[model samples]
Target: MDPLPFLLQPPVFYPIIPYACTIFGGLRPGRMILIQGSAGISATRFQIDFQCGCSTRPRSDIAFHFNPRFSSSDAHVICNTLRKDHWLDELKFSGAPLKKGETFVLLFLFLPDKVKVSIGGHHFLDFTYRLPLKDVDAVGLYGDVTIKELSFLSSNPLKSGSADLQKTPLSKTFPMGLSECQVIAVRGLVTANPDELTLQLKSSDSIPFKLTANFQDQTLSYNSFISQSWGQPQNVQTPFFLFYPERFFEILLLPEAGLFKLAINGTPVNDYRPLVFDLKSIEELQITGSAGLFVVQC
Candidate 1:
């Protein structure tokens, strides 16, 4: 039997400059491949490829190539496809989201329309699937850099049957809050035996608000950790059960007029005051722990 999507062994971390990993059973819709590493300070270029196979005595079939080149004064990303040893017209993007010597998170999120790439939690580029995604299997990386981590997992998780949607328990970072009166929503199915689920609007300095769910008591708690201190945990007991395993649900967070209003499955739950002031300080939206999250939108 094939390995579970989340349980697939991560590719061996490569300290050297070049490496490759076989992506068994191919890619699928609503899947993501995460690559974490740092580019060399003196490096000029690096490339990652989704290929048909890794055989290249003559040349292999490269389904998609994402390459970043920094040649002294010029920096850009090159995208193309290779078939039967012939290269197609190059599509060059003008921005390089990563610096030469900085650690970065590179996410390739596969949705139905396109494969969206993000750098440092910001959307960078989009490439349409010119062919069936399942036609590509292996992932190869080469050029001047070190690979800290590499893994592939499902992006959209199902209820009951797909508890192991993420191998090491999913911890995802998303963007949030365009203005003071902002709304954030998450659509997901909770795990059957979830010990904890934590969602936070955070920044490098402080967390404006945090939502914590403890399944053992079927209780929802809200708190804030600011200025090197943990605030009081206010239990929310309204609108009955806000969490139910084996069921699809929607949760929304709306911030306005010095209060944060929360709703579950489109039902009004409660409103609470801010524990930490200055909502503009919150720049990151993060979800961590054993929750089968499907969609998170701001």
Candidate 2:
């Protein structure tokens, strides 16, 4: 039910920051401006949260009114309901001009866990949390905000490919110490239909793997996904999130025998990719971005 945990996981790329490049673009409550009434919302509860902010704002809270007729104190500000203060340690900002125009860059970073921010070379803040990827939310911008360039540096670097394994096939290189491994590449515009998917991989290793959705017990369901060793499933914030061989691999749904197909970097995979014998659901098959960066899709 809660998206906080999934949101906390570290992302290979920074989430979107609204109006990242414009004359007046920054984190605002809503597109216009969020105001608090006498007895309803208050500035403390509402905010113009950057990528990250400390516990308090002194000079002027990021939230402001857009009516152009009201003072900041009298106006309402939207606030983040999510709790991530402990994970975020430093905040940074830059008013530098854009690369080719009059735009500006407003950058913020949540240190410790991961880095989620943008700006020029000044480099104001450092993320403090350890693998804090789930706490990120949509960027908000209100009155008079402009940003040109946005960049972020993560404290923890994500690993991709078998670079660690010297690009060795999972089945061949991984011996006894190896637990299990599976890689797949699937392509085609995703739809609600189960028959529209095909998957393939290259692995002679007999390791058992499962194909599933990003979220658990919802969206797409299948009866073919089989688990090699259930073991003690780790406790994740998301519902039905089960652990697989890869540390980053979090499966929620499974694919049926005929509904989904497989391949490996464009090559036809017959025995390398695992086959499904049971039913499992796939809310979504993540194959790009941070989740996709590690997974090759064709």
Q: Model 2's lDDT to the true fold?
A: 0.26
Point out the worst 10-residue segment of candidate 1 by lDDT: 2-11
Candidate 1 regions with alpha-carbon error over 4 angstroms: 1-7, 156-298
TM per prediction = 0.51, 0.26
Most lDDT-accurate candidate? 1
RMSD in order of candidates: 17.0, 15.8
What is the per-residue lDDT of model 1 for residues 175-277, given as tens digits with 9 covering 90 to 100? 4434665667776656667777778877778777788877778788888878878788888766455665544456788888677888765467667776666
